[model samples]
Target: MTAPVFLVDAAALAAATVGGVVRLDGDEGQHAATVHRLTAGESITLTDGEGRGVHGEVVEVGKGWLDVRVHELVLEPEPALQLVLVQALAKGGRDEQAVEAAVELGVDTVIAWQADRSISRWRGDKAERGVRKWTNVVTSAMKQSRRLRRPTVEFAGSTTDLATRLRTVDAVLLLHEEAEVGIGAARFPQAGTVGVVVGPEGGISPEEVAALAHVGAQPVRLGPHVLRSSTAGPVGLTVLASRTRWTT
Candidate 1:
């Protein structure tokens, strides 16, 4: 069986021995020891959420924490495609679900967009809370998927800001149900970095789509069936990753 993975901060790692012991704290610590019931000598993996992973063995277990000794550290290079998901904030828990799936599907980044048609709004304190919740979700998903790196989540302003961010990447794909072209037929730019934008439930407004297109973002259709806002981002990331040979 694969080793169970845990997310740790940079300070939890040591360079000389390439390993360090950390005192697991909070809910994560309780879950590791009590919920998983891990015992001494059991193997586990630790990640710094920066594309670095270490294989370690449990040395001790306590009511509130566990001790682990790292044996090896490995660093993986970032993916070639560098897929970024510009997901419009959706109602209920749909947007959270999208962020979770994006991390599992190997997205490089997740940008929360306050789209024109979005029912959910992120303003002031709610915005900060939203980011924290999404970050936690992404970290958990990464651990579940045995990923060494956690995707970064950011909040974007207007369609103009989204477009400006897209310009920094090699290419941008705007997924729309109304688009005439299918994603499979769309010619992706030579692999480097790419961004995929998914609209909210109400769909992307014409003005917003035009703004994205003005910045050279291509509109591509997923398939005949229209997917929910939550499902579209992950699906698009998978396709883009495959087409760019990012996963091979």
Candidate 2:
């Protein structure tokens, strides 16, 4: 089995490699030592969460610390094409679950979309809390999924704001059940990010679709069956990923 991976700083990993010792302290250390019950001589992997990784074995285990002997340090290059999921905020915390799984499925970035049909609203202090909550979710998912590259979670503001940002993306696909074109027909770029938009439970408003379409966002269908807001993004991303370098 592949060793369990923990996130560390790139510079710290670099310095530790020279010394041949990578230290794990703080909450992370406590978790590894106490919660995971990790013992000395067990193998573990450390990642910078930016594609850099180190494979090592625990040399010493303390009450709240661990020293690992570095064997190899590698830096993985970014994918030729990145996938970003634009998810509409939904109730019952399903949006977080979607992004969490999307990160596992190789989504490079996640943008929270506040659509007209969105049930949950983020404003004032609540906005900051929401971001933090999602950040925690994605972070945990990164480890759970054994992903080297940590996926980002950012609020996209209002739908109009998100629509305006579509101009900068290589391709924007809005998953609409009513659309005639399927995801297989999406016009992907040679390079850059492919943004996939998933609407809330109530679905995307026609006016909102028109607004996004005016800004080069294509309304595409997932399939004959309509999926939940949480399920749509991951399913759409799988199609997008398969069509791109993710399969290659």
Candidate 3:
């Protein structure tokens, strides 16, 4: 079985080497010991969450910390073409679900898009809490998915926000049911970030779609069937993956 993974301080992992000590303490340590019940001599993996990680075996277990001796370590390289999901915040926790699944599916960044039709609103302190919630959700999902680097979280206020953001991206795809082209039709940028815009359940407004498209974002459909806002981003990401890294 794959060893259980935990996140640790980057500085600590940087100072560690083969046969050296790596520490896990505090809530993480509590989770490793009291929650997961990992004992001395059990193997575990640790990542610093910036693509640097280690595989080691536990040597000592304490009330609030666990020490592991490093065996193997790896530093994952960033992808040439990063996938960004611009998911509109949805009600009933669907937006949260979308972020969780997208990170697991290898999305490099997730931007919370506040579309015109979205019922969910992130305002005042709720915006701060909502972003924090998305960050926490992605962090947990990374551990669960065994991903070394956690996916990023971002927020967009509206179609105007999205349009301005789209300016910096090399390519942007607006997921619209009314689109004539399928996802496969578009040719991605040679070496830059790709953005996929997912609309709310009420669907993307024609104005919103046009606004994005006006800024050079392509409107494309996943398939004949319309997917939920939560599912569409992941599916779109998977399709891009297949045509790129997972092509063969």
Model 2: residues with Cα > 4 Å off, grouped in runs: none
Between candidates 1 and 2, the one scoring higher on TM-score is: 2
In angstroms, how far off is 37's CA in candidate 1?
A: 2.3
TM-score of every model versus the real structure: 0.92, 0.96, 0.97
What are the per-residue Cα lDDT tens digits for candidate 2 across 1-248? Answer: 87887887677776866339988877778888889888988988888788888889999999988988898877778987888899999999899889988988888888888888898999888888888888888888888887788888889779888987777888899899989899998888857888999999999998999999998888899889999887999999888878776655
Candidate 2: C-alpha lDDT: 0.86
Stretches of candidate 1 off by over 4 Å are 16-27
lDDT of 2 at 9: 63
Expressed as tens digits, the lDDT of each residue in 1-248 for candidate 1 is 98888776567654414456655556766888998999999998877778877788889999967887878877867865677889999998898898888888888888999898889998889989988988899888988988988898888866777788888877888999889988887767655778889999999999999999998889999999999988999898888767675644
Query: lDDT order of candidates, best first?
Result: 3, 2, 1
Q: How many clashes does each candidate structure show, in the order listed?
A: 0, 0, 0
Model 3, 91-125: lDDT tens per residue?
99988898889988888988988889999988888
The TM-score of predicted model 2 comes to 0.96
lDDT of each: 0.83, 0.86, 0.89
Between candidates 1 and 3, the one scoring higher on TM-score is 3
122: Cα error in model 2, Å:
0.9
